[model samples]
Target: MFGGSRRVRQAALFDGASLPRKHISLGGWCGPALMLGKLGLRTEAYPFDFSRVTLDGLMHFIQNGFAEGFYPPGPPPYRPECVGPWVLFRGQHTAFAHFDLNDPRVQAHFQVKMHRFDAVLDAPERPVTFFRTVTARHPQEELALALDLEEAVARRNRSLDFRIVFMVHDQGLRASAVQLAPLSPRVSLWALRYRGLPSDTLFDRTHTAYHAVMLHSVAEENWSAVKVGVVPPPPATMASAEGWDFERNVLVCDGAARTEDVPFADLTITRFPWRSHDNLALIDGVASVGGTCTGIGSTKMLANASAALHVQRLARLKCRYCGDATYHAAGRPFRTDRPFTDEEDQLVLIHLYKILTGGDKVAAVEKLAHEMRRGTYEVICRIQYLTNSSTKLMDSFDPNSLSDP
Candidate 1:
């Protein structure tokens, strides 16, 4: 079916250019010569005028035709993908296809049907209506439509009805209504890459192809979390003057105090709550007790609580790289080029532990002063410096950039 006489007049307002048929398919030089003669564009070396042919405009034409019911079904000459459903309509700018949104078979499979109502209403005065329905073979399974078609009809101001019905073997058939929405005019064409399999032959090749699908959206936001291990210093021993020794316990942490439990080499627990502020408190310390640092056993015990909190915090953020975000946020700061020192490493562990345990701000600062062998004011200043400088650090080391397997 075609649009009404008045609607046809309105459609005439949009007179797009005719695309060259030769460009539609792959052919040798002879085909192009024949096509040029047919279209009257050939004049020995004279370039053809392509003012009307545009990817966007062509896509709009096809989408509009599909919405307006200008296309009829037949034994198509080429495969769906090769010639492309919209390619033939390139010459008939006013031609379109009527997508059966109410098709029961399609509804049964997809559950939802997205129609390009926008394309149908290109000529606002000519509106389209779509119907949908479903059926089940079992009496217990009753078919239904979720969308309100009447409301859609009134909204689109269309006279045509696109009815869809489903057939059930025993229960018979049922019908429903579907609301049609406008189709976007923008179209993007991309070259797809396909890899042939070993069993593939020229006549029957099986290939894996990858293509990107784009959608229009109003807004979007992305965030991520990193995990860092915090290992406390071991108690003072005769063998080493350092208060703690991670090598004996088999666990060593990177600068920010996120904890992790590896094999014997490291028994660190990967704790969560991946914020830089959270890790700073533990790395520095809280009050008189300074922070607790036992062997691997105690460290693991402490990490349990910290890790839980970290996970909960990450869940709250709803970040993409949840674990990595916590790790990076709690890790120790170091210039990419410089090597870390034992004292610096020990401090990192202490800071991570304190932060993980929900160490009090005032108490943690006081403990850091005692452990680092620095004054309370000095420790407080260091915490402040780290807090302020970390903003810049996170910008560069964004945990969101990391991919998850």
Candidate 2:
């Protein structure tokens, strides 16, 4: 949400690159690749590009194509671990899938159809004029129902009003699609990982993908609270303190030596996820095909959320420095005419507590000050310093800074 600058373009491209971090900054290969030749990034280019994409559904097609090919009905040709570095952008819907097994002899059933998953992902409320979800259940039937689609097609032929989406799951690529489309481009699959099983020797096929999504299931923990038009506040702990030496980073960013721009090769490494406390293992001992750490089985994956944590920290630090510089260079207009009232002082501390803690639930700083053995007066003094320095710093830059404060 920035004006006509690099920041604006960065925000626009987050969908193509990864999830929304606290903020987006120009770095690695992205900065020069997108910006320089065009005399750096522009805000106008982004919105224009977005509107065009939405109007034509170009990006949707690209992502849809990626997901479709990511998992094949049959075995994969190459080692899944050798594959990858697939970019993950946030989806409009949480994305889901559902399939049911029922007796084939029972003719009564409802069929779900989706012409394109991208359309649903783009607009969940877009009227179901065409593609919608359908899963037929045949209790007496087996998964092998996939093999007998000819009978299923005949049964559908007998019905006067047969919506194409409802059909036997075992139908071959063309048989299932013949009624609705040559091929139903829509696929409700997300969060795919490699399955341990290899391809059958008789027929070479794609590796079976164990996907987190199905036909019509939303990921609850990540997407249930669909509060329309709500903007999430920035993350308090910019980056987990585990990686960068916070204190040192600040000293360096505010005063580090020999700073050269880092490249994006390992910018590849930056987006990996961490081990959640879950106990598990890989599908077939093939954790990840790509060089990056997005493992398949028991291997822990790095969430895109963490990628920008540190980046924001660093950017925010530099941003504060730049803001202060810009302010001074412009002659300290940020020097508010009047001092903060007592109530305002408390409010400022309260805001700080809210921001620097566990997502507004707990005031980590208030407790941290105590744990650090700072007496009541020191805490007050620290708060005053923080308030004075940071008031102008709000909306100044991205988060995660260089080193320790």
Model number with the top TM-score: 2
TM per prediction? 0.14, 0.16
Which 10 successive residues of model 2 have the least lDDT summed?
Answer: 79-88
lDDT for model 1 comes to 0.22
Candidate 1 least-lDDT 10 residues: 210-219
lDDT of 2 by residue, 88-183 (tens): 111111110111111121102211112233323343332221111111122112112221322332342333221111111111121111121112
TM-score of 2: 0.16
lDDT of 2 at 231: 24
Off by over 4 Å in 1: 1-116, 119-147, 158-161, 164-405
Residue 347 of model 1: what lDDT? 75
For candidate 1, write residues 38-68 as lDDT tens digits.
3332322211111111112223333332232
lDDT of each: 0.22, 0.21
What is candidate 2's local distance difference test score? 0.21
Find the candidate with the highest lDDT and give its number. Answer: 1
